[model samples]
Target: MAQESSSVLARPFSALTLQQAWRKTNENPEITKADVALERSPRQEADIFVGNLIDERHGGPITIGYGRYARGQSLTEAMAVDDVMIVLEERLSVSTEAGTVSAGPGEIVYMPKGETVTIRSHEEGAFTAYVTYPPERPAHL
Candidate 1:
């Protein structure tokens, strides 16, 4: 009594709803705060994260968007709002041709527009935060 991928309504991976994943991940004794912090990027558009230990190193002459994701289709295709995030004190970092910088506690850096950037972290702790962009207001305020 099982269903095939084609018959399924949604993707298996995508099936993990935010609430479900949070609960399951938290319950999984094998999973730890450190594990979450080290988890790879989800690569979901509209993703947002806060907190984590980020660090980056300089690379050959290449403009790098310290906190930006690679280009993709629509904003949804690329992380925009609440996707691909780093937990606070999670050892996150970004390396650019110009220089390297790391986010500090209570510090946030928006991904630069049109730039190659890499983000990573390696820390241990219960990473917790959320991300959401503001709605359109007005220009030239």
Candidate 2:
């Protein structure tokens, strides 16, 4: 779901409430610290991940959702698509080959596709809303 896929509701365009999106994906378990860090299979959560939002597969495609990382949880990944994460609560840090960026509630951070990055939460951990792009699913997702 987050890694990528053909965009849904993009061609005709539609409006959906976050509540609706949650309803669509809720039957599935929310991604936890281990699912993302060790498993490298966030897309597995997509069994119930129903539909992409407003964009094309390669033309700025993105999927949206939220997840939580326990305090001290961390992971390094080779990104499969562009990731836009908004810290909903607490703080999160993303470190890449270039440098590192950190943010707290209301702040947003971006991690590009095809790069290796390390993600960690602050002592309080983090909860985030994310938009991931490219519409093409990846095994590592």
Candidate 3:
């Protein structure tokens, strides 16, 4: 009988096995309660956390900070900006020249430049997408 090889066989890179390939998809961003930090703004109380910030310039001044805010009071009161999109949860109201109305989850509220609006907490709090589109381009621009 031929002597059998006692050593372990070497497997190719393509022969590697995956433990599991499937996973449940979560829609909302993974924000732990412990990770939340409460902040006080003139508008309302905000639980702020840095999500993602994007620099829109080549070492210039245009930058976007993707942050999370949980406002329990009138947080964004009449603070004018360019635009915003609600990512996860619903909000109570968004003020505009036309009128204020209820915004649902995943709603995109586009407030143009100089559009005055106030946000009051109808429920306990709100999860929103904070956008920083300044009125005038920065001097570096």
Candidate 4:
């Protein structure tokens, strides 16, 4: 038998723009790169930036962040948590086990844990999005 945990009721919440979140994250020195797990392509670390918005400190079960990728920059990693990504600007190519899909401004994508995803900005101008995910689940689960 499994132990039960109390379920919290969901409520309405407020949100901030990508730029606003980015500014807030930068203002806090405690939110370091280690807190924002990003796997960039070789030699492209400087081309990608992630600004965390909501994390454990926010008292929420999920973390949200803003990611910006310079043209020609790419990042690849297996999803450690369920993630929802909403493209706010430019174009992004998301490659997964199913196939590669292209999303432009106003598009949203969902990826599940353990799914390998490669996000690339292939055109002029930077690609931006709001990404949200829950805390990584234990491997034994």
List the RMSD of every prediction in angstroms. 17.6, 10.8, 20.1, 10.7
RMSD of 1: 17.6
Q: Itemize residue pairs with steric clashes in candidate 2.
A: 5-135, 42-141
| lDDT per residue as tens, model 2, 1-141 | 121112111111122443344445554455332224332235333111122332343355456545567787777768778877666567777776666666776566777787777777778877766677764364223
Over 43-112, each residue of candidate 3 has an lDDT whose tens digit, in order, gives: 2345534332333443523333333445554544343446454434535455545556555544445555
**Most TM-score-accurate candidate:** 4
TM-score of model number 4: 0.62
C-alpha lDDT of residue 80 in model 1: 32
RMSD in Å for model 2: 10.8
- Candidate 1 lDDT tens digits, 15-121: 23544655665577754334433222335342232222221222212211112222221122222332223223333344444444444333343443333444444
* Clash count list over all predictions: 25, 2, 2, 0
Error (Å) of candidate 3 at residue 70 is: 4.9
Assess candidate 4 and give its lDDT.
0.57
Ranked candidates (lDDT, high to low): 4, 2, 3, 1
lDDT of 1: 0.31
Q: Would you estimate the TM-scores of all the predictions?
A: 0.31, 0.56, 0.48, 0.62
